[model samples]
Target: MSALPRLSTIFLAAITTLVAVLLYSPLFVPIVSSFFTISHGNVDWSSPTLSTYVTLAENHDILAALRTTLIVGVCTVILSVVSGTLLALYYHGRRSGRSILQFIIFLPFLMPPIISGLALLIFFREIGLERSLLTVVIGHTVFVLAIVYRTVLMRLQSMSRTLVEASYDLGATGWQTFWRIILPNLSSAMVGGAILAFALSFDETMITILVTGTQSTLPVRLWAMMRLGFSPDINALVALILMFTVLLCVLAARFLIPRQVATERT
Candidate 1:
């Protein structure tokens, strides 16, 4: 029995390590290569330099794409959070058709990205809507909205009704109770959803490609550059984006975990 347990632990540990490597190797390759140069198609691992980072700064085309991505991310975050929160709030107290309506709202997220992209492309054409950054933002929001909505709705459902009842017993108005009691508790959930939405928006490519007109986000721009071959500075850009994405994930964990623990303890 002891040998069996020990062997299982070893197996699990090995599998975990293998999975981590498989997941992160692609990310690490670009980050590691950003500080080194290639000679005759071989990376010069013996020497590392900041030349790639410097060149990345001066690359106007990539910089513009990065800026566009940021703009789209911020806009997507705002639109997703507001719409999601409102929908979550609306559904929470309603007795009718919430499940059906939620299914409709989540269709974009639940369907394959290719399907969603093609559907949106057709919808835009039917409406005579020209593709642009606006369309990109719309696509991102649609894709990420279900995540934000579910996050907020889950938090709302988990909240104790006693808190709101107590606020009402103290003669607080509906708006006052929400502002002071409910919104405060939902704040962490909202923030986590926003971070997730922003991350998805930043990395979105398939939907953006179908919706965008000429001006492209970073991922779309990178895809186009692939045909012409990548610049060395692209490695540096990938490194920076990886670091930023990790930071956002860390921040989201920080905001979300404590609230979950508190709720569990309560």
Candidate 2:
């Protein structure tokens, strides 16, 4: 029995390692090339330099795209968080039509990105809303709204009812209880959801491509640039984005883990 268990564990570990390598190997090339020069389609590992990063700073088009992506991401985060939180709160307080409303809210997120993008495209055209950064922001917000709603809703569900009751018992008004007790508890979940929303928006390509105007976000610009092979500065940009993505993951974990631990303790 012990030998069988050991063999199973080893098999699982091997499979996990293989999956991780397969998923991450492609990213490794860009990160490594970001540090060195690529000559004749091969990396020259000797004499690594920061010239590529300097070039990235001077690439006006890429910088503009990066700025646009950041702007869209921030706008998406704000809209998604506020709207999702409101939806979550509203659903939490009501029982009638909750299931249908939730399904509606989640429909776009659950659909294929292409399908969602196409739907949004048609909707915008029907309404005569020109595609622009605003449309991209709306697209991203719709795509990420479900995540924020689910996060905040879960947090709301996990919250202790006793806290709310105690506030009422102390003669606190509805607004006072929400402001003093509920919002504070939901803060971590909101932050985590905002981070997730921003991350998704930053990397979003299909929806942005469909809804974009003259300006494009980073991922869309990168996709367009793929026909003309990537430069060293592109590699540097990828490396920086990878680092930023890792930092967001770390921050998400930092906020989410403590809430889980505290919930478990309570």
lDDT of each: 0.90, 0.91
Can you write out model 1's per-residue Cα lDDT over 2-61, one digit (the tens) per residue? 667887989988999999999989999999999999778899989899999998888788
Model 2 poorest 10 in a row by lDDT: 253-262
lDDT tens per residue, model 2, 1-266 = 56678879899889999999999999998888898988888788888998899998888989999999999999999999999999999999997999899999999999999999999999999999999999999999999999999999998998888989999999999999999999999999899989988888899989899999999999888887776876788888889989899899788767765656577787
Cα RMSD (angstroms) for every candidate in the order listed: 2.0, 1.8
- Whose TM-score is greatest here? 2
Model 1: lDDT equals: 0.90
Off by over 4 Å in 2: 1-4, 259-266
Clashes of 1: 0
